[model samples]
Target chain A: MYKGIAASRGIGIGSICRIIEHDLTFEARQITDTAAEKQRFREAVEAFVQETTAMAADIRKRIGPKEAEILEGHIVMIMDPSMSGEMEKMIDAGQCAETALTAVCDMFYGMFSSMNDDMMRQRASDIADVKVSVLKKLLGIEDVDISKVAPGTVLVCRDLTPSMTSQIVGGNVAGIITEIGGKTSHSAILARALEIPAVLSVPGIVDAVKDKDTAVIDGTEGEVYINPEGDILARFVLKREEFIRKQAELNSFIGKETLTADGQKVELFCNIGTPKDARKALECDGEGIGLFRSEFLFMDNTRLPSEDEQYEAYREAAQIMGGKTVIIRTLDIGGDKDIPYLKMQKEDNPFLGYRAVRYCLGNPDIYKTQLKAILRASAHGHVKIMIPLVTTVDEVRGVKSLVEELKKELDAEGKAYDKNIQVGCMIETASASLIADLLAKEADFFSIGTNDLTQYTMSVDRGNPNVAYLYSAFQPAVLRSIKNIIECANKAHIPVGMCGEAAADPLMIPLLMAFGLDEYSVNPVLVLTARCIISKWTRAEACELSDRILAMDTEAEIVAALKIAAKE
Target chain B: MVSKKMTIKNEQGMHMRPASLLSQKATAFTCSVKINYSGNSYDCKSIMFLMAACIKCGSDIELVCDGPDEEKALNDISEFIESGMGD
Candidate 1:
């Protein structure tokens, strides 16, 4: 078994078909007829453009327009005057077309590779790709037609390029193994977009595998088996079937409302960090935006984002959500997230020090800018303000007062806004959980941030490896706190949502349902899976399991019980 | 030469798409379009040069256009950059 980067999730069993790179070796000689050489270079470029354009069209239809853009970029890159023109200049000086192409590509490749930005650095690889394709054209070499590969063929290559990936027929390729490339590389992105199981950056994979060799790919685990034992292959076959069956089940849950077996409906939402991610939440069939971390606008900028900038960001998300709830968590920074511009003094224990709501309330100018922006955005859709790290009732009240002040200011300025926009508290601290009823009465809603709740409740620094074992939302103490927070919210007739990793855990879903969680907000990709899990348990069954879990004394015993009762 | 200084407002500055668009638009003009970033001059008509400049969001750069249509070129390119390069 070989370990590699798991680029895409799924299991695939197939016969290997190694994609050997073509040799484009050529003899360089001085040419007296520079005109003819320049013509040769231009023709080769034209041919490259024609072929790439066709492939872009095919990929656009087969995969997506976004993936097609990678191919379409090649045409634009090669046609750039700095590219083709430079090559022609070198060719006009009596250099061979191959030499000219290599020289110009190398220059741009060096320019892009030296950049500090990751996205700009990827352009260096794009230059290399263009060089190879144009070189192949000049050398009169044929590419391996990936579209014609036999069904169930697992492709082994050094690295998958966008042009080569464009020819892939998803049904024909069962899996892909590459010698180099990471999860975010073009190879991985294309493989995932095609929905083909892929294991990338496997060392010596191309040279080790032969055509027709049987292989089993556990893409989820990033493990590959070459000509495995009969029993191992049989086990993998069953695993593959189970994965496919599970995926189909999850896909069927899309476009459906979140409901329990006994017909209790709940909100299924997604946690997003940026405005653009709202589109992904919609794509994943999320009912609303549960937690929109508003720190990206500040973290990604050198200076503090202006009020107009923050408003545009919030309005963009609200517009994309189309009236769905967008709970914007105002700047939860100064903990592990240190922005240089903020100039927050270094603290001995940052997480326990001035952070989140405490920092915001102290810095009224910054806090008011964000609050007013959010209030202005509320006019576009269902926008809510969620205060983070609220340990005291005054923190929630302070934020509410600020919102009220901002609303009055907006009214005086004759600015249109949502007057009834909800202000909520993110119950993450032990103090907040203990005084949940007070917070529930003061705040409009509650969203449990289980990560920090578990940490503060158990006095375990999740970052400390030695204490990591103690940091789990399933811990009896943490579970009880979650239960109390939910009960407090319910008793006050306010909606309570959970926007933490535990909210989507299949084992934890039933307990949350039993606790009467009004909303579950998880990663966008987990929406269907969470909805599917929620549909499996009736309230009575969940309550019985929760009762048993709540009666357990230790985390280990409760986890064991929950695991046994978990529905797959 | 006509020139104007502007900050790149696009979330991702001078990436493939923006570079391509800027270069294509610049190529249509009968002028020498160049971007002066961090004391370095980059040909705006070349996507390769524009991308290699690595001008990120919030980077203040000068757009210079020299030739018969320098005024028109500078105005158009400055407008495009100010509009976040159609991002």
Candidate 2:
């Protein structure tokens, strides 16, 4: 059994289909006519650009603009004069076109790889992608299109690039097993978006599993069984049927209102990063967008987005939601999310340093621009602003004052906007949870960012592998913090919602129901599953179970109690 | 000859987008345009040269143009930089 991170939930049984990456090696030979070599390079680049542009258009129509933008980035790289100019200079010095391209691309790749910034370093992979595409064009190599693969085949690869994943159309692939990538990797995200079974970070998986070997992948369990015995294969076949049946059953809950057995209504929403994702959220029958991450708008661009640009994006999402509440979070950058334009200083401990609301508070111009955009978008649909990483009531007040000021500015300028746009605070930090009542009074609503709340309450860095085991939302301390936040919001008569990974967890859903959570905002794919889980339990029984589970001290004991409660 | 000093306001500095834009603009002129940053100068028509200069955000650089259209080239390039290269 090969253990890995279960990136997307599903069961896949199929014959292994290895993804053979073409070796990107070329023979270096000096060319006599430098101008001819330069022309050859230019032609290849132009062709590659044209090809990628067409691919981008197809991807835009099929997947969405965000995924299509990856291909657009490739076109930019091809058109980049720095790369082509360097190649021209090298060719002028009597080097072959392939050799010149390789040397120049490798230099940039090395520079990107050595960078301290994670996002910048990831650009190295993108450079490699460009190199491969151009090199393939030059060498007349054909790409192995995944869409051409037989249905029910498990794809085994070292890593999948955006280009490769884009070719996986028409449900041709059954499962994906990669040697590298965590839960947040590109492949994992794409797999989840495509609703494909995927197991990632399985070391030596490509080497261990041969082509055409029967493999059973349990994405939920994070296990891959290669060449299983007769009995095991038979058991997995039965399990696969059951999994399919369960998924069909969950689909039935999609258009239905999310309610407990006793008829207590709970809003099930989706958390989206981009405006394009609102379509997926709607398809999953989300009540609304609980957490619309606004940082992606800043991160994907080369410069600060104009107010018009931000307004257009927000308006599109609002129009799609069609009066459904779209809770958009303000620029939550800093710490892990570094924007080159912002020029934020590096900190020893970024998580606790100047980030999120702190950064917004300091840069009033940037913050106000986003606020104005959100306010303008509110005129189109149900839009609410949610401030992230608030630890003090002062921050909430400061944001409120800014929103009021922006609203007045819009009104004075005769620009149309929603007069009564709601504002909320994300109860993520321990301090925020402790003073939730105070925040509740100032804000229209409260959404528990359980991922951060768990990290803060447990005093564990969730990203650090050394202490990742301790970063559990079910921890007694974390659970207590969640309970306190919910109770405080309840006392203040403000609706409390959860917009974190924990909200999607089946084990935590009943406990949250017990706490009287008004909403559950999770990934779009989990909307139906979460609704299904909520429909199975009565709020009264969940409240009773919460009391029993809260009395437990250890994680194992709490888990044991949950198992018994689940059977009920 | 015409020359102007401008700071790179774009967050990503002289990355591929701005470098391409600047080079394309320079190629349209009849003048020899060069960018000087941190005591080093590079031809503005070469995208690789501009990007390789590694001019980051907030870094001030000088654009010098010589021959016909030098004044127009200098003004247009400066304007492009000031506009954050359309970001």
Candidate 3:
């Protein structure tokens, strides 16, 4: 059993089809006829451009413009006289066209691959992609057309680019197994978007399984069983069938109110990073957006987004929700999110260092620009500003004052905005949870960012693989902090919600429900699953179970109890 | 010859898109354009050479242009760099 990240939800049992990336190799023979070689190189370039242009159009038509833009870049690279000119000059220097092209491309690729920036490093792959396509044209080799893949085939490859993933979709691919890629890698995201079961980051998986080998992939459990024994195969086949049935059943819960068995309604919201994700939230029947991470706007670009750029993004999200609450978090940079333009000092422990609300509060110009933009977007639809990593009442007060100042500025400028726009704070840090009552008085609502809360409370770096085993949301200390915050919010008479991976976990659902969490914000893909889980349980029983589980001393005890309770 | 200093404004620096754009513009001119950064000069008409230079964000590079249409090439390339290659 190969354990990897379960990127998508579902079970897929299919014959494995390994995709060995074609590495082009050629002999370097001296060319006496420079003119003919140059002409040949030009012909190859022309063919490459024509092919990429057609592919771009097809991708645009099949997928969308954003993905097609990758192919469009290749077209520009092929047409760039600098690249082709270098190749032509080499041809004129008594070198074969293939040798020249390879040398020039390798030079460019080497530079790109050595870059410190992730985006720039990805450009190296882009250059390599163009090189392969051009080489194929020159060698008369057919491109790997994943679109023509046989249905129900599990695609096994080293890795997949967004362009390759787009082709794999609608090609009847049952599952995807990649040897490299994290949960947030392009292939994983594409797998989730395509709703195909995916197991990623399984080292040497391509070599372990041969072509036409029957494989069973459990995306939810992050396990891949290759050519399993008779009993295991039979069990997996049954599991796959049951999973399909459960998926169909979950679809029935769509459009249905997220209510407990006793008719206690709980708001089901979605967490989104980009404005484009708002559509996915809507499709999942999310009641609102609990956390619209604003950092993506800052992190994806070279510089901070202007007020207008931020406004358009926020407005698009607000307009899409159509009065449904959209909780737009302020720019939560620093920590794991390093924006180079910010020029933040490298810290020994970044997670506990100057990050989130601290960074925004320090940079007033950056903070106000985003504040003004979110407030401007409020005029379009329902928009609330939520501050992240707040550990003090003073921080909440500070942000409120900034919002007040921005509101007055907007009013003076004759710009209309939601005068009653609500403000909230994330109860993620231990200090924030402890002082929840003080914050609840100033803030309109509270959303527990459990990921950080767990990290901070346990004093564990969740990203550290060494200590990752101790990073559990069900840990007694983390649960105690959550319980304390919920109780504090209840005392203050403000609704409390959770916007973290914990909220989406089926095992944690009952505990959070029992704690009387008014809202549950999760990834859009988990909305229906969460709803179904909520619909099946009574709030009172969940509360009772939560109370019992909270009394447990260890995570193992809580897990055992949860399993028993879940079975009951 | 006309030389002007410009800072790379795009977050990604002189990446493929910006390199291609600059190279395309430079080739359109009869002038020879050289970009000098960190004490090294690269042919501005070669995208491969420009990309290999790895001019990151906030780097100040000098654009030197000579021959007929030198002024036009320098002005256009300067404007493109300043615009952050339409980031």
Which model scores highest in DockQ?
1
* Candidate 2 lDDT score at position A526: 90
Candidate No. with top TM-score: 1
**DockQ category of candidate 3:** acceptable
Name the better of 1 and 2 by TM-score: 1
Off-target runs (Cα >4 Å) in candidate 2 are A1-11, A19-27, A30-54, A84-94, A133-147, A157-169, A177-210, A216-225, A230-265, A268-516, A521-529, A537-562, B1-87
DockQ in order: 0.78, 0.26, 0.35
> In CAPRI terms, where does candidate 2 land?
acceptable
The CA lDDT of each predicted structure is 0.92, 0.86, 0.86
Candidate 1 lDDT tens digits, A1-568: 9999999999999999999998877888787899988888888988999999999998889888889888899899998888898888888888888998998999888888887878877788888899999999999999989899999999999989888888888799999999988888888899888888999989999989899999899889999999999999999999999999999999899899999999999999999998889999999999999999998899988898889888988999999999899999998998899989999999999999989999999999999999999999999999999999999999988999999999999999999899899999999999999999999989999999999999999999989999899998989999999999999999999999999999999999999999999999999999999999999999999999999999999999998998899888
Q: How do all the candidates rank in terms of lDDT, highest first?
A: 1, 2, 3
Where does candidate 2 clash, by residue pair?
Answer: A82-B47, A82-B48, A341-B11
lDDT of 3 by residue, A1-568 (tens): 8998888878888888888877678889899999998888888889988867787787688766656777788777666666787788889999998898888888888887897766666677778777877887788888578888888899898887665776775647888888877676657766876779999888999888899998889998889989889999899889888988898989899899999989989999999998878998998789999999988778766677889878978998999999899999998888888999889999998988999899889989999999999999999999999999999988999999999999999999999999999999999999998888788899999999999999998899877799998999999988888888888888888889999999988899998888778999999989998999888799779988987998889999999999888821
Interface RMSD of 2: 6.6
